[model samples]
Target: MGELVSTPLPTQFGDFLIKTFSSGNEDIPHVALVHPEVDFSKPVLVRIHSECLTGDVFGSRKCDCGDQLHLALNQCGAEKGVLIYLRQEGRGIGLTNKLKAYQLQEQGMDTIEANVALGFDADMRTFVPAVAILQSLGVDKIKLLTNNPIKLEALKEAGFLTVERVPLIGEEFDSNRNYLNTKREKMGHQI
Candidate 1:
């Protein structure tokens, strides 16, 4: 059995709360739930989102992170699932570096290239904590909502059965076109 670490986070959304669990590593914080009640065994709908402050908080048009998060919240609230907000900003590079990457993007670098230029891997995030969090909550299966195939593969490999892939489809505009395209072409995301 994996060790479980958790804490409550208050929010304005309906019954909103955050529960975090350690995935045998201090750096990675696995999670379960952002709104409503959390139930691990209920075949939840999970959204494994990487951190994005500009997009998620300010509704920045540079990426679909915020929109996707909003969609997930609505879906999870209605369907009773979990939204695991991983703190892996910029795919694990953190907010400061993500901003730097954004600047590089302004100079014509794609998201992946900008991360590489900043001395970071293209995608440094790991799914171990997510798996650990689900297991700790007794969730052995889920209906994951995402466009990233890798997330499904990782969760499955880590022993969480992805019974469904609920696509977080939405419109992308000029400001985020390149970012979305890069995610599709380079990252193999199903955007």
Candidate 2:
């Protein structure tokens, strides 16, 4: 686990204490956006969002990452929750591999198929870092906001008590409908 660096960030969602966690390096660090009004009396609301540069920064229509990110941020801000953003781009495949998978996707393969074709698993991302961050924050339990059961199960397996599972459902567009559908039907995402 990495050490947390305290940084203040005020965004449209609300005021947040941004903690950047690094493993003895100044490179890309994982971050946690903590809402100011987080109350320990109640279970902390949390979202673990993996990095998606194409969708998150550039607003690519190929995935629902940007929409989910905005939804997570808005909801977490409103409820005084914590959003842990992990730097696991393209579900843990690098950007170049993701683009190559995109080419395979264009040729009629689904998202998972494209990834498997490129010699990777369907989803390489994990919730271990998120769990570590929560533990570092002294959060014993949380109301997790996610559509992926993997996250919920992972939290339990990691020994964090999940008080609630808040659904994060984003709108589906033509560009990402197949991607979303593949996640739901094949990968067991709740959509």
Candidate 3:
């Protein structure tokens, strides 16, 4: 994917230079929110976040996606970092299938079991696009904000010289306890 457009975005967190990267999908381009003073010469602080419509937009309590997203944004704003928002909805299963998985979860299955029963992997996302975006922006070393071990390994395997993982913890609720447990136990998330 290549950068398609860029513009200024002012938000509660701060003013940002927003860039969209796409492979012809205008409606669902991967987005990058860059702080104005971000220093690419140093190990840039970065957060590669996947889209989560239900949780992120609707404030669904079934997971902590929205909470983590806001937390990352706050940190990025405070630290003059970069936040890469990937359009990999529902761990790459797309939105409809994700809803179906939620149905399965209501039937007493954890997140992993629900996705597995739907004939998909526990997590089907790839970090290739994130790496590409960072590279295109002249970023080599990074302090990645994440709780997923896969992200750490993915960046390391992609040849980032100094990939330091910065843990991003969020508030937990009863509504998402099981989901968090599934992530921490089955999916190897450092929740």
Candidate with best lDDT:
3
Off by over 4 Å in 2: 23-25
Tens-digit lDDT track for model 1 on 1-191?
A: 34454455554444555666654466765556654565656678888887788889999998899999888877877777778877777788889999999999889899999999999999999877677666766778899998999999988888777898889976799989999999999999898
Evaluate residue 109 in candidate 1 and report its C-alpha lDDT on the 0 to 100 scale: 94
- Screening candidate 2 with a backbone cut-off below 3 angstroms (N, C-alpha, C), the clashing residue pairs are none
- Candidate 1 residue 57 Cα shift, in angstroms, is 1.3
Ranking by lDDT: 3, 2, 1
Q: Estimate every model's Cα lDDT from 0 to 1.
A: 0.79, 0.89, 0.90
- On residues 59-99, what C-alpha lDDT tens digit does candidate 3 reach at each position? 98999989988999999999989999999999999999999
What lDDT is obtained when candidate 3 is compared to the true structure? Answer: 0.90
Superposition TM-score, candidate 2 onto the true structure: 0.96
lDDT of 1 at 80: 71
In candidate 2 the C-alpha lDDT for residue 98 amounts to 96
How many pairs collide in each candidate, listed in order?
0, 0, 0
- Quote each prediction's TM-score: 0.86, 0.96, 0.97
* Candidate 1: residue 140 Cα off by (Å): 0.7
User: Comparing 1 and 3 by lDDT, which wins?
Assistant: 3
Q: State how far residue 191 of model 2 sits from its true place (Å).
A: 1.6
